[model samples]
Target: MKIALIAHDKKKQDIVNFTIAYTEILKQHTLFATGTTGKRISDATGLEIHRFQSGPLGGDQQIGARIADNEMDLVIFFRDPLTAQPHEPDISALMRLSDVYQIPLVTNLGGAEVMIRALDAGFFDWRKLQD
Candidate 1:
């Protein structure tokens, strides 16, 4: 499965921690992430991730494109709700695309844990039927 790992500025460290904790499960699949977040995750966990531009610079849109093209399956985005993002519209669009395409999206650490567990259990095989 192709998984996207995204995190807002304040949540970047949290995502890196999550990646470190779940390295074994995560390293089993292809990973993609926005610039700084990707760098931090890769550096911390040594997982190979395809990195795109920074979120405010179109990274979200790039991942959204993969989602739209049926090239993406899961999205783990650690959003900082208290902070305001300059690229809010792009974030909204990316989320909307996830919904439109029926992709599994986890917006917080709790949800990401559940989704990652499900992934480990092979529950996402249902996604193949959608394709």
Candidate 2:
């Protein structure tokens, strides 16, 4: 499975911790992330991640492109809803594309935990049919 990891500034630590906790399962799959988030996770968990530009600089769009192409399977985005984001439109578009493509996307830590577990349990095997 191809998983995309993304997080807002305030939620970076939380996502990093999540990645650390799930490193074993995560390491078995291909990972992609935005610039800073990818660096932080790679540094903390030693997981290899394909990094794209920072979100505000076009990372969201890059990931969205993959979703549109049906190249991405799961998206774990730790969004900081309480804060105002400068690139709100891009973020919205990313989420919208996830929905449009029927990709599994989780926005909070709890949901992410469940999704990661599901991934480990082979719940995402259905994604292979789309290919």
Candidate 3:
């Protein structure tokens, strides 16, 4: 499965820790992430992630395109809702694209954990039918 990862500045650490804890499961699939989040996750978990530009610089749109094209099976976006983002439109687009495509998106640590667990359990294999 192809998994897209994104994290707001404040939630980067949470995403890193979550990735680290689930590294074994995640290592079994392809991973993609936005610039800084990808670098931070790679540093902490030693996972190979295809990195795009920073979110504010179009990384969110890049991932959104993948989602729209049905290239991505799941998205884990750890957003800091309490903070304002300069790239709010990009974030909104990503979220909207996920909904439009019917892809599973986890916007918080709790939901991300559930989705990762489901991935580990092979629940996402059926998604291959959509391709």
lDDT of 3 by residue, 1-131 (tens): 89999999999999999999999999999999999999999999999999999999999999999998889988999999999999999999899998899888889999999888877887766477667
- The residue-level lDDT of candidate 1 at 51 comes to 100
Q: For model 2, name the residue pairs that clash.
A: none
- Model 3 scores a C-alpha lDDT of 0.93
Question: Is 1 or 3 the stronger prediction by TM-score?
Answer: 1
Question: Clashes in candidate 3: how many?
Answer: 0
For residues 8-99, what per-residue lDDT tens digits would candidate 2 score against the true structure?
99999999999999999999999999999999999999999999999999999999999999999999999999999999999999999999
Model 1 TM-score on a 0 to 1 scale: 0.97
What do the candidate models score in CA lDDT, each in turn? 0.96, 0.96, 0.93
TM-score per prediction, in order, is 0.97, 0.96, 0.95
How much does candidate 3 score in TM-score? 0.95
* Global local distance difference test of model 2: 0.96
Q: Which candidate, 2 or 3, would have the higher lDDT against the true structure? A: 2
Kindly give the number of clashing pairs for every candidate.
0, 0, 0
Q: Which candidate has the highest TM-score of all?
A: 1
- Sorted by lDDT (best first), the order is 2, 1, 3
Error in Å for residue 9 of model 2: 0.3
lDDT of 1: 0.96
